[model samples]
Target: MWRCALPPLPRYPTVDELGARAAALVARHPRDARLRRVGTSRAGTPLWLLSVGHGSRQALVVAGPHANEPVGGATVLRLAERALADPRLCEGADATWNLLLCLDPDGARRNEAWLSGPYTLGNYFRHFFRPGFLEQPEWLPEGADGATLPETRALLDLQDELRPFLQCSLHGVDVGGAFLELTRELPGIAQRVARTANRLGIPRELGPYDTLYWPTLGPAVYRIPPPRRGDLAAAITEAAVESTWFHPHPYGTVTAVVEAPMWGVAAVEDPTPPADADAALRTVSHTLRDDTRLLEEILARVRPLLGCSPDVARLLAPVDDYLLVGPGLADSWDPDLRQGGTRPLPPLTVARLTALRLAGRRVALRTAGLLHQLVTASGHDPRGVLPELDRLIDEWCADYRDGCGARWIPVARQVEYQARVVLAVFDLAERDARVRSRSGETGWGSPAAVPMHRE
Candidate 1:
């Protein structure tokens, strides 16, 4: 038996705690790890990057780029610890992998408070808000007027100095499960990632660029248009002009913005598995170990060809545009959000009713199913209340629309639509026999609903 020495998993740490923990781990590890102060947040928190591995000129740029997406940070930290503890993993991989983890300290910190608490639906809704492009330290809008945040500047400097072969910006979403989107030049890499997720029983999907509900600058990038800005994408494009002043790397760079939904992992665990703290720790460790192995295998296939692919830049052009433009209801030609601009919200149709409702139900079932799988994978049956909850959400949206009349539906309509459905599910889980019998033991309630405020 390879006795695992991993400690019991703690609740997700806050950004400050996570950074401190990462620093301590790096300090304790065997490898020569150096911490670099990359930049500072608007709040003045210092953003740090840990550099490990020695010899190969190639760099593996990985960052928990999104604030709420903490798993990637956890994964990177764990992977670093493992790599340091066992030299064998890095024996042939030395110098070639300079990992840049946690690029957004401010965002990460903002998310930490929620992570330390109970992982409930209400908690997530209350705390989670995507940062706008200008809000992001890495993004520079046109005519910034000398308002560059420190974190952004540091990242630019790091990019210039390191000039890594690949940049992997780790992000996560609330919907759509586990999938990888890469430059079309790296389709094989995406397929490999999808296959790995599937092998682990993680829900996987593809074609994120084409299937996004709204325009996305990149796969995971979200941009908010400026007030009175008619051409959202054009404004973004114009904003990019300011980015030229901060170009860090002389060589063209290809960035892959990856969004790994936490639901993917939440969905696959054996619901009824042993709850003994020690046993749970072991189970999670083993699961992560297996995941890492799969990732390494996929990387092995992609690493060798990065330098020689002449079309890599060309293939990445569209991806770059997508990220820079940030998805919107508008596009390059039309950016106005008011004039039913470029990317109008996905038309509210019966089709969306079906998709949104299906999604809501699946999420509910997946939550219950995950717990069940963790406890007992074989006889697992997610409670039936989720279906009813889904129906309620669909009906609520339909009713609301009918009452409000057709020509225009506010963005708040969609937010309320999702929230109402979530609330219905939580309510039923607390009362219904099927849901009560399984998840009722735990008092999971919706977070206090915040009324939409319109001026």
Candidate 2:
């Protein structure tokens, strides 16, 4: 067992760095703890799962399921520490805690530049990476058993073996504020989460993104509509072909997707509806529509350039294709307005729109950069189009960052919020129809405050 080395706790660690830390902890407590190779990432990085506590009812908490969303790595590790220190954290409900530090190591390696950081907005946006829609874990495959990506298959295999009663996917954004996605709601879960998140200094997402399209049970909590057949493909292609092979994990398991922004923008937390709430929301819709239109315009310029270079087309066209797809929020929310009086744009609507647009542009810009490389590598000489596209993308990125002046969401807060939510949700499930989640409590200490041993 290697001792913890190379850095202090609470820092954003590389996939290897994090793996070492987890291994070191298991090394410390050999009886109740052991580390196992669940699977390997596409890039051939070993996927590690640290199991602490021996219980019948299983809970699997996955962090960095997506390569770019590594913020949860620390959160999952912290939870493992707590469980190890005080086994009671996993004592009830026969819950054996299996913490998967990150399932997507290949993409995570791409994000390592910003993982350990000054945690600045500029660094994050510059090094930002997210797997393409079809490449993600939960959303990647049509069914549970057959998965193209080794990472997905590994996770699906673990679930088959453990059939976790609860699954928590920890994810964070480079911009915007915190939000929660519930596959199914457990009573009293929302209030407990909101209170804990607030106490830990993380604000709920006030942006229109989650609120605009998804239904919220309470502040910042959105019920993610599970995908049916073809919904995954439809996400990319506007066309709906029946996805007969698709189905999310069955109803018995409860899952929570914790999405918190790396930098907490206080403005996003404000509940005061902007004075022109109605117009503000319409503007938000307009921004997405306009951005999508611009994305298509940019893609058109580059698509013709890729024809002869199937190498380039194979490598770069799908990225351009994704950008060509419309941002669906505009259409998804149109019905809400039809039933309404203009409610104030949720406090973070504009900021959310700004961040969302920025994320889209960043991906497009990366697409442009890769296209430029493909052009040069393919030996396509005299044409100057790719360079022009690169310059255009860089200019847009600079302008967007400068205009927003976004703050970095502190790493501590990000971890604590996620840790609390995972524990809270698991505790709720343990009660399993026992203790009713009561209202009226707006601050710290829920049934989740199971005595966790701290190091």
Who wins the TM-score comparison? 2
Top lDDT model: 2
Candidate 1 lDDT, 277-340, residue by residue in tens: 3333333334333333432343243334334342333222322333333322122112222354
Candidates' C-alpha lDDT:
0.40, 0.63
Worst 10 residues of 1 by lDDT: 442-451
Off by over 4 Å in 1: 1-10, 60-62, 85-91, 94-96, 143-147, 207-230, 233-253, 264-455
Candidate 2 C-alpha lDDT tens digits along 327-350: 554543333444456343333444
Q: What TM-score fits each model?
A: 0.51, 0.76
Q: What is the lDDT of candidate 1?
A: 0.40
Off by over 4 Å in 2: 1-10, 207-211, 230-251, 277-318, 327-405, 433-455
| lDDT (Cα, 0-100) at 138 in candidate 2 | 56
Question: Could you tell me the TM-score of candidate 2?
Answer: 0.76
